[model samples]
Target: MTRQVRRLAERTPPQRERYADLLRAVAITAVVIGHWLAIYVTRDGRGFQGGSILQVASWTRPLTWLFQVMPLFFLVGGFANAASLTSHLRRGGNAMGWVLGRTARLLRPTTMLLGGLAAAALTARGLGAEPALIGVAVWLASIPLWFLVAYVAVMVLTPPMYALHRRAGLAVPIILTVLVGGGDLARLVLNVPYAGQANFLLAWLAVHQLGFAWQDGRLPSRRSVALPMAAAGFAALVLLTVVGPYPVSMVGFGGERVRNTSPPTLALLALAVTQTGIALWMRGPGNRWLRRLGPWTVVVAINSMIMTLFLWHMTAVVIGVMLLYGTAVMPDAMPGSALWLLLRVPWLACLALVLALLVTLFGGFERRAGRWAASVGTVKGVWPTALTIAGVGAVLAGLLALALAGPGHHGPTGLPVRVLVAYFGGVAALGFVRRRYSRPARIAGR
Candidate 1:
């Protein structure tokens, strides 16, 4: 690990923003820990049933305020994507090429996650595991995966959006945000079914645009500027949650009639803005601290495994619980009891150990994806465009299927049969795009 960190530190561009890496690490870590803390799995006489500390402990709803970190992700995503695209265009890169690169980077590790889960689900069934248990296991393991769909959707739109950014400056995000507010009105007030789904992109686009602002220096680092931004964001959030109908959670609570996160309500956007202000305020200090070797080394190492770690953290929890209970040594404590609370510390530690093992084994997919960035095809004109659209559409559709259906959900495992077919078909469609339509070297250079 030290050697890996040393190599990363050596290869890192001097002007590269270390703060982004730090933020990524911090965001993922907070999410992992928050999941461990908030999820309260209970074992009734009928094996394991999933529950949440938030359900039993209402005080923890406020904790979601601090722990909800998805906003930070889009904020950072917008920043990174803009900077990357701007640099790529200067080097004469094409839009399809950029899209292929980004999708591959995300999907490489994703293939491992989905593929492995399918295999595991199959094996459990072969070993005579019950379908209900399999369903719950697959569902909980996949909790982290839904984020990929939203992120990739936003990523696919980056080229045109960046163009819009170049022309309209900050107006693009403002317009998107206003649309989010409108969506909120439509969904909550008019009771429109699925109207809020639009904000899944619109709300995130708003935060992502701020990333553009941060990159171009339009978002000033002045405390006066940041403080007021924070204050206003905080104020709006209070109004929405306290005075209005929005839930206070930055994340969705199980069984809640209204969830701030599942569809992304206006209050969550308010939280994102507030977090953006705080992130900007702290950027300087964070960067300065990252200038040193030791701290930066940890950041580099963590960033290298970022995708693997995020994807597998929940799986680690499932693994830990199984090993502990399956062994029949550790007595199950009633959830929310003094002993149950006391056991959480050790439980988290065990979960971390398993997570480390998973990362060590699967983190290579991310590295391989980085090396395997490829252009879609040699075919020119709308042919390439058509293929790119089809490819992305197929992948999104497969992911949605997987998100909706658990892996190996087919009475027997063999592959999360439907999901495997969907996701693999999507990947093949993408691969077909690259092979069948790749730009020839001669014209690509031109």
Candidate 2:
């Protein structure tokens, strides 16, 4: 190993390995492509169609295996949380405060983006655009914001959840398995949304709990993680297609009666386990390559701006589409045929180029606030408090904006109100609770 790789390995926390960042980069890239294909591949000049793309790529259903990589993001999150919490406890720092500070840093840019989008929508409306078009734009724009809400919830709940990992031992996976099986049955018998919105805590949280296992060193040994993960993932896919009502698409299409993502089914959890295992297996080679890339500079640079990239990639696509409109180069209609899918290659390239430019220009959202700027760091126990306050304020402001401006108005509420509310509220609640319990640790001497 090179000096850099040796250093990284030495510094590697027990819970979070260097390979997890590589996994995150890969997962995010997959998400971008998956979203792009799901949107641009099956459109009819107005919106998406369920049948067209599915028929073209019957394999699209299995893309959920790749596309469901979002859970891996959370899995890494759990590992990071475990490591951070352990470090904080050892040093007599406030665990809650540490989580809050990090959570705040994560949430600040998201709130700003939502606020800006709301302003833009209002400006467009002021210019006398049609209500339907405005509504659609706002709704579409708000889609990426869901990750912010979900991530916050995971961070906030992680402390206690990590504790549970120690107590429950392997029973944790047993309970999750039961929930997965039971959830499917309930959805079938009840014919209700019970499995959809209701399992937000159960399903996705279950995946996050697996991350805790990784932290506690209770997960399978690094050398043996892959086989079980692949086996579990394959089994979940078979079960979902065979017995469950969930559609296999990771990205939502307009006409699918059941979305694998809306509540995240057993299939997604299994997929995470498989992906995590593969990621762990790849870590050794990956770390060597990452080190060879020189000084951790490139990886560190990308890590700094990941949030910005995630938030704006779709915006880049939107800009590309708009710029191409009203030209012969532009498609007269959205592509549905295999020929059109072939033709769309250049369009996809153009979209990627535009996204890169936008990110280059406006990616500062990922930067941490300097102490003088907003006091949002991990120092002095104040940063986390500030973060919690800001996050809560943002959610409240968003809710108030929704109530005052109505559902049709600009801001976070313009999306599915229930989802927005649930996500934001969950984040805020988690931050508050984490902070509350972590106070005593901060008071103790290091």
Candidate 3:
């Protein structure tokens, strides 16, 4: 880790905005730790039962507002991608090539995760494990994959979105926020069943656009600007939850009739605004703190294993549950009990250790892929960039199918065969594709 951090720190350009990297690392790590904290697993002979603290304690719902970090991720993603795209254009890179490179980085660690789960399911089944148990394990382990689907879709759409950013500026997120409100109305007030789902794209896109505003200086970094923005967001969130139809939790915990996360309602947009405000407000102190080599080194090191951490985190939890909880090494106390709360410290420690080992083993793929230059690889015989899109499409389709199908020993290779094909085909496309500079790239000069 020290060697890796030294290398990364050496390559860090002095002008690079380190805060964005800090946010990215913080966001992804928080989510991983949050998952480990929320999920509770126990064994009943041959069966495994899992539930979250939210199922037991209702008062914790309000805490979701503080712990939910997905919005912050989209915000920072916008900041990073905007900078990256601008840099790519300055280097005479094509959009297709950019899409291919970004998708590959996102998908590389994902492939390992999916592949590992599939193999684990098969091995468990062949060992005479109950199908229901296998299914539960697989489903629980794969929960984090949902983020990749949304994130990849966003990455694929960046070029067009960036173009819109260039033209519309802050109006984009505002319009998106209004649309998200409309979506919530349709889903809750009018009973339009699937209307809320649209915000999955609309809300996040809006948040991403805010990142663009931050990047281009339209979103000012000042106490005067950020504090009011945060106050307004906090007010709106309270109104939406307390006075309006939205639930209190930013996440979809049990007992909530509506989930702010599943489709990410207008309330989440409000939460995003608040988080953005706070993040911007902290920029000055954060920037100064990060100027020191030691602090910046920690940020870079964490950022380096980020994808690995996000992808394998839940897997690590599952393994820890089976090895520790299943073997009775970690005692199970009632959910939300004093003992249960106390036990979680060790539980988290074990999960983190397992996760570290996973990263050490599988992180090589992520590191190698991360070091890849930001351009499409060129091939001699065919149009690889075209295939890049098709591949990404297949990968997305496959991931969606797998999530819909749910993981288990019920299908070929422990998952639906179609999903396997989609995933493998997509990975192949991105891996084999080639890059060719085009006039369009020059036209998009920074």
Candidate 4:
């Protein structure tokens, strides 16, 4: 066995919470629908409905409020990072190496996805498809790429982030509140350049930091976590509606007056606080239920592929929509009346079926290979590690910006095809490097 694996074996088992897995499952399911619904263009092309059996389902939007917990996703990510990092530290594992290894795993599948999409786009373009259609396809395909960029930024900055967590203590929240409050002020006064986008790093990192706190047991006990979270969520909603310029929607759409995303506003930060609180509050009950659910080997098994699901769920939705398009059984126009919405139950069911099938087929990307276990490395210095992650992320972000930015971005023609192609290419290149550089010991450690 590799040294890292042996070390892991020698260590005591860390606290295992099935509820976290359950929460992750819930989060992934929500994201599936979020992405699916966001792209779900209605027939008149006026609003979102797929030109498929799912065309009748418009009732899904209300669920957005419930399921659009992207903040929660980060919250959980933070929690997991804390747990993993803590475990690694306890085991005398290299912190920097562990972080890089985890980050690398996250990026690998994403890279493969980008490459596949790029190849498909190139082949279609070679066949003389209109440039506009190609651009739209590529742009649509790249929608989930943002998560990768944001996630890497968070992971790469982990060393300093952890240090900040150690030093700031409760001051972290005060700083976050100030930053979020300032963001609100800026939105009211100065039109910041990609201000919301900028916060994809800062705002979410704060939530992730909360996860670290959870690991350290610094958060309040289970009894108290929920009420505070709910109150925080309520307060955030009030601020967003009354005081802040941000919109209510967690996911961006074309027509909103102002987006809650981009550079995340105070509202989103509030959402994160609230989400963290809720997750913590439910921990007691959630853990008990998850424990009874039995080994949760399946959920834990699925964890390996969580990134895969996130990356491909949208693609599955697109494919399902395409398959159902131009069929009379499927409505060209989405249901307008209440009765039509009621009839959409079956269509939504059908869409779900299609999504499941796709997941089964392509989800293997989530599984770690035997080779991965063999590739391990010693942890390096924090600054060097952070710089490596930052450098890579910066390169990707710059490339994406160049590709995705344009006039009439709302139109199909304006979708970012070239940038997406580059992204996939970059991912593939990274994966190649990983495979080449992977050590047996490191893989085992992971």
lDDT of 4 by residue, 261-303 (tens): 6667677677777777777777877766655333354565456
Relative to the true structure, candidate 2 reaches a TM of 0.78
Cα RMSD, model 1 = 2.4
- Candidate 4 global CA lDDT score: 0.60
lDDT of each: 0.80, 0.61, 0.82, 0.60
Residue 36 CA error for candidate 4 (Å)? 2.1
Q: What is the alpha-carbon lDDT of model 3 when measured against the actual structure?
A: 0.82
When summed lDDT is taken over every stretch of 10 residues in candidate 3, the lowest stretch is 373-382
Q: Which number leads on lDDT?
A: 3
Candidate 1 lDDT over 20-129, as tens digits, reads: 88888889999999999887765658787667888877777889988899889888898889888776665566777778777878888988998788789888888888
lDDT of 3 by residue, 1-446 (tens): 68868877878888999999999988998898888888877667646677887777777778888789999999999999998888776667766767766776878788888899889888887888777777767777778887878888887899999999899899888888889889888888899867878787888899989998999899998899999999999999999888988888777866668889888888888899899999999999999999888889989888887888988888887788878885555776787788878888889899999998999999888877775644342222246556767888899998888778864555534677888899898787677663333223444443
Evaluate residue 244 in candidate 1 and report its C-alpha lDDT on the 0 to 100 scale.
85
Of candidate 1, the 10-residue stretch with the lowest lDDT total is: 371-380
TM-score of the candidate numbered 3? 0.94
lDDT of 2 by residue, 98-121 (tens): 655566566656655565565666
Ranking 2 against 3 by lDDT, winner? 3
Ranking by lDDT: 3, 1, 2, 4
